[model samples]
Target: MNRKKLEALQGWSFISPALIVISIFVIGSIIFTIYISFHRVNLFTGYYEFIGLDNYKRLFNDTKVLIAFKNTLSFVAVVVPIQTFLAMVMASVLNAKIKGVKVFRIAYFLPTLTSSAALTMIFMFLFSLYGPINQIALQLNIINEPINFLNDAKVALKVIMSMNIWSTVPFFMVIYLAALQEVPEAIYEAARVDGATNVQQFFKITIPQLKPITTFVLLMGIIGTFQMFDQAYIFSNGSGGPENSTLTVALLSYRYAFGQNSTMGFAAAIALVLALLILVVSLIAQKLNKSDTLY
Candidate 1:
């Protein structure tokens, strides 16, 4: 073989294993899921009856699906902005030349290292009726009575939101911290020379420079919050109870896919819808942020 052809063949051989694995697993699974979404699948009997768009149609008419979508959207809307803002603020604080800064950074990042399941359990305990949160509120006259955070429909989802924000902030904070290093000190120096205050510099210089990182953080937050399941599952014990306040679309899809009365076709449909929703929302967010431009 010619040297050019031989190099091309060698390069293909190097990538062939990964291509084969991806083709058989990732691509294969997606194709199978699309096929199953259009069928009535019976796993036990190995039966698949083509049902056309019936499964997709059922999603719109199902009240649980509606509730799930509402909850997921609320989660994404609230968590993404709050977490992104908090991450940026915390990153700025930690990036300063303050004493014991390393300790503070480690303390903040510890929660991110912990598993979501464990964090959920910890928050559940902390927010329990007589936990420290209630006790502190009671002592401070913030509440007349200890609130039942877990079982109360009004607060159940909010409690989960708080937990998610707390745990995720540290991760995105680290991202912002890394991005902060890339920001030119010369810009901040110029701002200071222009008699700009710290807050002014942060808003005008730091924030504008970190626009790309903020976009990344926002996208990650949106995707993560939309697909929230482990915390909700552990919080509601897989029932998404308390009037379905904590019922996320991901948890709902899991229920349909593996519950006692499994409906694989509907589960597949829900999963595909979620993937499309994420894609559209992400694209819109990217467009709005204009992450392609630095300024």
Candidate 2:
């Protein structure tokens, strides 16, 4: 072989061990999941029965699955937009040159660094009926009485949504901060010379320039929220309790795969559907992000 070809072959040989492991574990697992999604198999007994699309078809009549779909859709709809807006606003503030801004930036970014499970526990404490949040609200007479946030079906999901928004905003804020650096100061100055207000300059110049970054934020937010299992599992204690208000697709899939149900095929089908939902939402977000309507 030529010297260049020989060197290329040697490089492949070096990485082939890692590549083979990933293919078997990651790619092989994905194929197996899809395969099992079309069959009924006992994981413990190694008994496999081919039942084509039975699991997928059952999803149509499953009430819990329906609830999970609604809750997940609601979460993605409400959380993504609010988080995107909060992140953009926070990033703009941090990107500004001001005294002690760096300190504030670091403080704001701390929540994102925290583990989701830990954060959920913290939020649960804060929102508990006898917790500090209710106590403070009572002192100020803001609430007529301390509401049981954890057990209330009406507000349980909202509490999770708020906590999720608070935690995720800082991470996306950092992304927006990086994107903001790419905005040319000259454009803002030019807008100022034309008597464009700060708000106008923001809408006209800053946002349009950061369209690609916004797309990235939306795609990430959609995927993350769609597959949100950790926070929901922690909050509901894996039961999706208080009337199944907090049951997400990922959490439901977990219940099927490993919970009392032990329906791995149904779980795999749910996961596959969730993946497709994320893909579709991301493509739509990308198209909207590229549009010139707002600009």
Candidate 3:
């Protein structure tokens, strides 16, 4: 073989393990999922029969599926911006040279490193009817009695949303803090010399420079919020309780596949729809980022 052919063979050998792993774990899984989505499968029967789009049709007409879609959208709409903005604010605060800055950063990031399951347990206790939160509210005469936060359809989902924000903000805050460190200090000094106040320098200089990081964080937040399974599952105890107010697309898909109903094919279709939704959202986010860069 020629020198070029030998080099090509060596390169392939180096990457072949990764390629094989991805083909089996990622590509193969996706193909298998798609195949399953076209078949009718039952729990008892343990047999799959090809049924071409029937699962898709069922998912379209399923009321719970519709509710799940709405809840997922609402969760993303509320959580993504709130989490991202709060992260930015936290990043700004920590980016400043202050006493024990390292400690503050570590404290802020502690929640992200801690167990989410444990956090959910603490939140559940705090949000319970007679929990400390409601006790304070009662002392303040905010309500006649302790309110059932997780049991009320109106407030259950919102409580979960709040939990999500608290748990996730730390993770994104670290990202923003890393990005903020990369921004040149000379630009801020120049702005300050031009009679710009702190707020003015932050809005005009810091924000514009952090645009790329903001875009990346926002995209990640959207994807994370859309695939929100842990918080929802923990908060609702896998039922997405209080009349399905907190039912997310991910939780709904799981229920369809293995919960009370064994509609594996329909669940697969839902999974595909969710994957497509994320893809479209990611594309749109990229386009918006591109547009922002032009200016």
Candidate 4:
């Protein structure tokens, strides 16, 4: 065999084990989930009954499912834009190489270093009725009483939204930071020569150049926020309570799969639908952004 063929074989050999493992675990599980979605399944009793599209049909009649849909869509809609804009602006600032920039970077990135579950717990404590947030609000007379952010239907999702934004912004900021570093200095100099101010250059040159990164930030933000379950689950204690305010589609799938009744088929169907929703939304966003256009 030629030396080129031998080198290619070696490369494949090195990667083949990981590829096989992924095919078995990730791909296998996905196929199994899709199969289960078409049938009634009970894990404990090994009960399996063919039900075809009945589970998907139940989605229409399930009020909680509809609520979860609304909540998840609202979360993606609100959080994606805010976080994307924030990340870009913050990246622009950090790219300026100011004094004490390292300290600021570390402080901003601390939340991203923490695990999601840990962050969720900490946020819950901070936002709790008797927690420091309310204590300070009370001290400042921000309200007549302590707001039950956790228990109020009107504010529950908003609390999660705030936590999500705070935790995720730094991570996306890092991505934008990297992209900002790649912006050619010549481009900025050209803009300046054309009598463009910093703000004008940012809006006209930097933003346009960072379109690909913006798309990535938006896509990841949408997917992450759309699949938000851990925070909502921890906040609502898996009951999706306060009038089902924090009930997310993922948490709802958990309830269906293992809650009062184990409707595995329904849970799988819900999951499939969610996957499709994420795919469709991401595609639409990419189409709108046209991030693949060469600069």
lDDT (tens digit, per residue) of candidate 3 on 1-295: 9999999999999999999999999999899889999998885778889999898888778999999999999988998899988998889889998889889988888888768788888999999988999999999999998899989999998988898899899998998888888888888888878999878876887778888888889899999988989888888889988999999999999988897659888888999999999999899879878856412
Worst 10 residues of 1 by lDDT: 286-295
For each candidate, give its TM-score against the true structure.
0.95, 0.94, 0.94, 0.94
| Stretches > 4 Å off in candidate 3 | 2-4, 291-295
CA lDDT of 125 in candidate 2? 99
> lDDT per residue, candidate 1, 1-295, as tens digits?
9999999999999999999999999999999999999998867678899999999999999999999999999998898899999999999999888999999999999999999989999999999999999999999999999999999999999999999999999999999999898877788888889999989988988788888888888989999998999999999999996999999999999999889888999999999999999999899878977745444
Off by over 4 Å in 4: 1-4, 193-195, 285-294
lDDT string, candidate 2, 184-226, tens digits: 7888889999999978977888778877788889889989999
Whose lDDT is higher: candidate 1's or candidate 3's? 1
Residue-level error in angstroms, candidate 4, position 178: 0.5
lDDT of every model, 2 decimals: 0.93, 0.91, 0.88, 0.91
> Can you list the residue pairs that collide in candidate 4?
none
Residue 146 of model 3 has an lDDT of 89
Model 1 TM-score, 2 decimals: 0.95
Error of 1 at 118 (Å): 0.8
RMSD from true fold, candidate 2: 2.2
Off by over 4 Å in 1: 286-295
| Top candidate, metric TM-score | 1
Better of 1 and 2 by TM-score: 1
